[model samples]
Structures are given as structure tokens and as C-alpha cells.
Target: MGLWRVFYAGWQMECCGTPFSVGDDVSWQLLLVPGEEPASRLTGPAGHVAGATDGIRVVQEAGLTVALSEDPEPRSAGAGPADPGPVRRSGLLSVETHGGAWPEVTGRVRSLHIVVQDLARGADGTWEPVPGTRTLRETDRCPKWFRGREFGTDTGRRRRDEQGVLVGLEVPS
Candidate 1:
């Protein structure tokens, strides 16, 4: 569980539960109970209570009559950094293309996706020839056509051919 404190205009406020920031143009009114001594109060430009202290408790229960008013300012989405979920450690590999000829390209499988493919060992002693795989032909060179191509790498570097065409084959770590 996460714990947080409540505050009003920098002055700490007593609250049994977490307090959320009020949006702009919105006003909040709270009551307080008077104590034996006089309470210190700070009022805002609009006569809204900004801060208070000195023998006064925010009216958590009935019968107390201390009034607090506030018009909170609007909060913009640019006020803070957005929460980017978990960092994904994946890579993309691509083969180079030659003069007017498209290199035969294959996609790399990642994690659980590898289980769905039939696996075989190549002369290099690495797993090769995934089942249900498709090959890229030279005619399919449009950028939009390769949008969903898959490739994996232990490092995040993209693999490319000598001519700089992406081959989409990851070197195993």
C-alpha cells in the first residue's frame, strides 16, 4: 500500500484518507473545530482559506464550525512525466539488399513465440528453420508493406545488409 499526506497551500491538513489534488476552477469547503487557543489563518486572494494553524482541527466530526474554502488551479498533463510502462528488451534484425535483388529474409522469434515454431539445428549448431515461417521476396520492397516484420536480438542493434536494406535476422547471443 502507498501512503501519502494531505496538504492545503503547503500547510499540512489532517485527513483520515489520501487527498487528491483538485482541478482548476473547482472550489472545496471544509470545516474545522476550534480549540482552546485562537487559530492562525492565512486567506488567499479570493478570500479562500490557504493555510491555518494554532489549536484548530479540521472538522472530522460534527458540531465544530471552522470554515475553509479553496479554488484549486487547473493541472495540465505537461506538469509531469508520463508513466512509460515496463521497458522491453527486444531487437530487430534485417538483411542487406543487393542490386535489384531482394535477399531472402526471415524473422526472429522472441521468448514464448519461439515455442510455436518448429525448431531445427543448422551446421552452425544453432537452432534454425522455424516452422510456419514466411520469406520476403524482392518484389516486396515497400516501406509500408514491412511494418509488422519481426526480429529478435540480445542487443538492441538493428541488422542491415551492405546496401542498407533491413534483413530482419538477429544474431543469437
Candidate 2:
């Protein structure tokens, strides 16, 4: 079996399950179920926002099947890069798990280490890179993905009011 890591960020943002390691050319469906009350509370008031459940539901229901391989490689569409970006710091969030069917034999995503990446500035100048870490605040709109492909794509969108502040760091993966 090969290992695959899946990440979900945004509203209802707790990471779920362990990294899946399965056989080659295999396809499986993933069901992203609603988290329990304790987990939901951890998300705070931001979890009550509009479309939050829908987004989470999509990730939950869109089960992923892995093609087992002697060589380790992911075969899912929309899968981000293994090395997503530059690593600015250590000790971010990470989770591990054995490969298997959706919603079955899955493990709770504990406090895994992640390398948080640094935020960058845009041409319109809405966000500026600040030094040090702050709480990730809840915003009127959903939190921004700042890095990845979505950055700078929609310049006219309004910024969301931040709620909880998380210390920002840059990770290479």
C-alpha cells in the first residue's frame, strides 16, 4: 500500500482521517461526514456561516479511491502538489492513517505537525505581509486560500472579517 495525504481547509476546517495507503489502479469513493458537536464547537461561530455545510459536505461525499501502486503517487483530480509551497516554519498540522475504503477503517486526525506558509501581497494591495503571528479571525466571507491557485484570481472580492488568529508559517509541502 502507498500513502496519500488529503487536506481540507476553510469553514468547518478540522482535518479528518489518516493518510490513505492503498493498492494500485484502485478507485474508491470518499464520504466527508459532519463532525461531532465537540469537533463542531472547535470550529466556533464561523461554522454557522452560509454554505459552510455544503462545502464540507462536498469534500465528505466526494470519496477518493486510490490506485494501489508499487510506486507512491496520487491519482486524484484536483489534488494539490505534494510540495504545495515553500516552508517558512515547522510544526504546522499533519495527520496520518492507513489506506482503506471511505468512512471505514478511518482514523481521527490528531494534532499533526504542519509547516505553515507565509502570506504574500497582491497588486490591488488588500493584504500586506505582517511580521509575527496573530489569531485566525472569523470574517464576513469565508477565509481566503491566500496561497495555491486561487491567489490574486479575484481582486474585486471583499476581505472577510477574521475571527480566530493562527500563527502563520510557510511550509514546502
Give the winner by lDDT.
Answer: 2
lDDT tens digits, residue span 1-173, model 2 = 21233233332132332121222121222222223111110111111123222222111111222111111233367874332122121121211133232222133222222223334456776554334422333222222332222234343433332222121112111
- Give lDDT tens digits, candidate 1, residues 13-70: 2222122221212122233122311132322222211243422222111111123221
Q: Where does candidate 1 stray beyond 4 Å?
A: 1-19, 22-25, 36-38, 42-173
Residue 91 of model 2, lDDT score: 20
How much lDDT does candidate 2 score? 0.25
